[model samples]
Target: MATFNVRPDIDAAVAKLSSTVGTKREIQHLPEVLWEGETVEMLATGVYGKGNGLLVMTNQRLVFYFHGVMSQKVEDFPYRSVSSVQWSGGMLMGTLTVFASGNKAEIKQVPKDQGKALADLLRQRISEATSAPTQAAPAAAPAGDIASRLATLDQLRAAGAITDEEYRDRRTKILDSL
Candidate 1:
């Protein structure tokens, strides 16, 4: 991969998107987010115009963004979901190919250094994702939630916000719901 001067056009596009894009920090703590535990590792600017795109590598996924002044599209491939990742072409431009969930996505005409860096970062993340214990969330979530609820109920009862009978009823309901 050859490192080229980042053109003013690429920098300008990146600057515009940075403020508008939703980042890992903004979504990681969301309870309903599926690709949980993701954090941005790197981001790179791509070609401009309707074909303008962003390459974002996260701890849990590789994300591609296609944007124009009028519209935008974002695609995510979780490291676990990816079957293979490959790249080709020369120093001036290249393509990134990712096979995931039985489908393939190719990001074309990206600068060589950006594409190679993205590929290297993705390979590292994929290896980590594969070795890590899979989502243990389901096993621990209910126990943690129930314990917290029990504590809150105890606090409410002590504060006289709820009668003992009411506290007991709510606590039992919370336990049963779990």
Candidate 2:
């Protein structure tokens, strides 16, 4: 399973939330996945509120809802600048955009300070999404042989250990030397 180092403040917030809500909290951090030898980092987190509400935050968006009722929507949150977030009953009811030009945070809401619970809920969601998978580990490679070498080569290629050209060259050499 992937792991992430949670910010100290976020970790503290999660702890406070678990105690306040009287439920066990789960946290997760996901590493970047590789596709076609390219690495992509996409981070998201969630928190569950007092009711059935949820708060979700990603690199690009922040969404809050309860049982399908839309309470808040914020977009383009400048994923690079987010330091930490806190929740209270009324602090998160509207959209928030941080402006880099002036180092200011702009918040819009129907009633200000109404989104604390929602923020907490989103933190929880992120925690759950990043939790470790429960599946069993794959079996180890067998003893060295044509089949084993081929399998190892395939695994290495899949893990981006060698370029396609290098893999093809090594595979040809292995087969010829056999």
Candidate 3:
């Protein structure tokens, strides 16, 4: 059998998330598959968007995974498509906001240690992607990916977290990117 090792930091992050997210073996192994051959740069908790899950940053993409008692969802934002990365909040609670391919994800109330480092790394990657034309254009997301995003917006609207206007606007933007 061929066996591969998972990074200790990633194991720690998964363990941290599993306290509330439960021990899903697949979830623990997701980063390894999704970011194969890529570097897992940072891992931050206390994210506020898409139901507050763990945020995983890699050299190639930013992937957020949220798990409920029985449901699981993930969102991926490629570095090449990212246009803005902002850091905010106070010393005690930091927030990281990433804008990519017209989608915005705000990860709020992150721990101070990971927040600053994530912001710096994101800024550097965004800058590099912006300056280099070859790497600036990220590959288009798959059609199924767009469909899932639209579904998420619809869920947000159905739950009354967003207005009908907001849903329409976001849906339009997601579609336009395809």
Candidate 4:
């Protein structure tokens, strides 16, 4: 396995690669965006290595974005301070070596097959994290026409006339019929 130290001239390589592929390449230098009083900056930009995959970096992390039919955060992994790297089955896998305060840690890439599983797991975690406890909402009085029905549903949900589940199911059925 060969690990190429990324040089400052990475932009030149990106240009040449884009030219060879006959596609326009866009390199976005992430600007510092203030979110909730925290300054966020993208440490790495554009695609690199053999495949032109998306690369993202933050202040202390580097992430390689890979494709997965299922959305998963594990689909992306850190690539900085990598001690070993290998390409396998059309995917890049490696062990990242990180050092802080003279201490080291190893992080391995999630296997391709496991990537899907990892994605599913992450999806579940996120779903659980974001899910609020269901509360009963008031039922909406029947309104005339689809527009009125939707408005009634919205009003009912807002006014605690129906539960969230009821609102969602009724909305889906109404939309489907239309």
Candidate 5:
């Protein structure tokens, strides 16, 4: 039998990610699967079908990973592919359902607070992604506001929170407003 080992830094990151909702097992494979510019935003424990795993929200996608005895499962829903997200919370737990790519994924037993926050954030991102193409270019911001936004955008790019293409597109839009 082959075993998987996690590096120290990634182990720490996984621990921090699991702190909020906890986990049934160590998720060492997560960092290895993230895109170059992706950043973890939230994580919750849940069950999808008979598999129990972690529901992870990143800057670019929603990822569900389940590590089973003989195999593993991973599913990712990108922001652009997602149509909508819904959350229903009980006293302590919630269910998060994601509609995307002609299908729906339902994850149950998520922490109420984390699930609600993840659902709201996913909805907002989906809205922005779906509406961005048709919307007119943003109006020019005030000089000071523009400076602040530009700085923040630059930081995001530098920190790998946003991809190079995203940085260039946003930078062009900001510069065009001037």
Candidate 6:
């Protein structure tokens, strides 16, 4: 997986999307709608309601944006607001459904190969956002302890205790607090 910066990096976002499976037509509108500091993690082409759009999973939110000849629609669901996400793929297409605040948003016709990955990433983001910190700041563990802590984290990944994405996120947090 590509590393998405926590800070807004339009060039990186564009480059990442270009390599992913999706339509580039809507990429032009991203700069205008993306929130400051948001990072795009995944993108898929799908249909939301009656409009064809791009479903974007970002560091902070899930967004669906469509620009047509007559109208434009942009819908964003913050990670914290997302209660659950599910993905189902058929032979040629997939569906992604997001449940948030008693509302449900479903995007259909997602690229089959991209659906599960996007859903899993969204679930990971939601879990990270909703889970309360269970311990005191590792930043307080002494400057000399940082290296050892990172090593332990890496070992946990190697041992299959945490996913690669989780390791990267935790590592980034540890480094950023430095």
Top model by lDDT, which number? 6
Clashes of each: 0, 19, 0, 10, 0, 0
Cα misplacement distance, residue 98 of candidate 5 (Å): 0.6
TM-score versus the correct structure, for each prediction: 0.51, 0.23, 0.58, 0.26, 0.63, 0.64
Which ranges of candidate 1 are over 4 A from the true structure?
Answer: 1-38, 47-50, 133-178
Measured with C-alpha atoms, the lDDT of residue 46 in candidate 5 is: 88
Please give, for residues 45-146, the per-residue lDDT of candidate 1 as tens digits: 554334556676666677776644466566778786675789896768888888765567877776777678788878887777657664332433568788
Superposed model 5: Cα runs more than 4 Å off? 1-26, 135-178
Sorted by lDDT (best first), the order is 6, 5, 3, 1, 2, 4
Across 76-115, the per-residue lDDT of candidate 6 in tens digits comes to 8888667789898999888999987557899998877777
Question: Which regions of candidate 2 are displaced past 4 Å?
Answer: 1-61, 64-84, 88-113, 134-178
In terms of lDDT, model 1 sits at 0.61
Per-model lDDT = 0.61, 0.39, 0.68, 0.38, 0.74, 0.76
Candidate 4, residues 1-178, lDDT tens digits: the string is: 1222233343433333312221122132222111232222232222333333333333333344433234312123222222222322226443333332223433344334433333333334334433549554335433356777798888867754455666798899777655
TM-score leader: 6
Misplaced by over 4 Å in model 6 are 1-22, 134-178
Residue-level lDDT of model 2, residues 13-122, one tens digit each, is 34433222211222322111111322222222223333332233443334333332334222223332333344333443444333321233434342233244444544
lDDT of 1 at 68: 44
How far residue 87's Cα lies from its native spot in candidate 3, in Å, is 0.7
Task: Estimate, for each residue in 1-178, the C-alpha lDDT of model 3 and write its tens digit.
Answer: 1122466656655444323333244345565457558766666766665466667777787777776667676877777667678888696778888876556778887777777777888888777765654323236878988888888987866754455666688788788878
Give the clash total for candidate 3. Answer: 0
Better of 1 and 6 by TM-score: 6
Could you arrange the candidates by TM-score from highest to lowest?
6, 5, 3, 1, 4, 2
User: Roughly what TM-score does model 5 have, to 2 decimal places?
Assistant: 0.63
Give residue 52's error in model 6 in angstroms. Answer: 0.6
Report the number of backbone clashes for model 6: 0
* Decoy 1 TM-score against native: 0.51
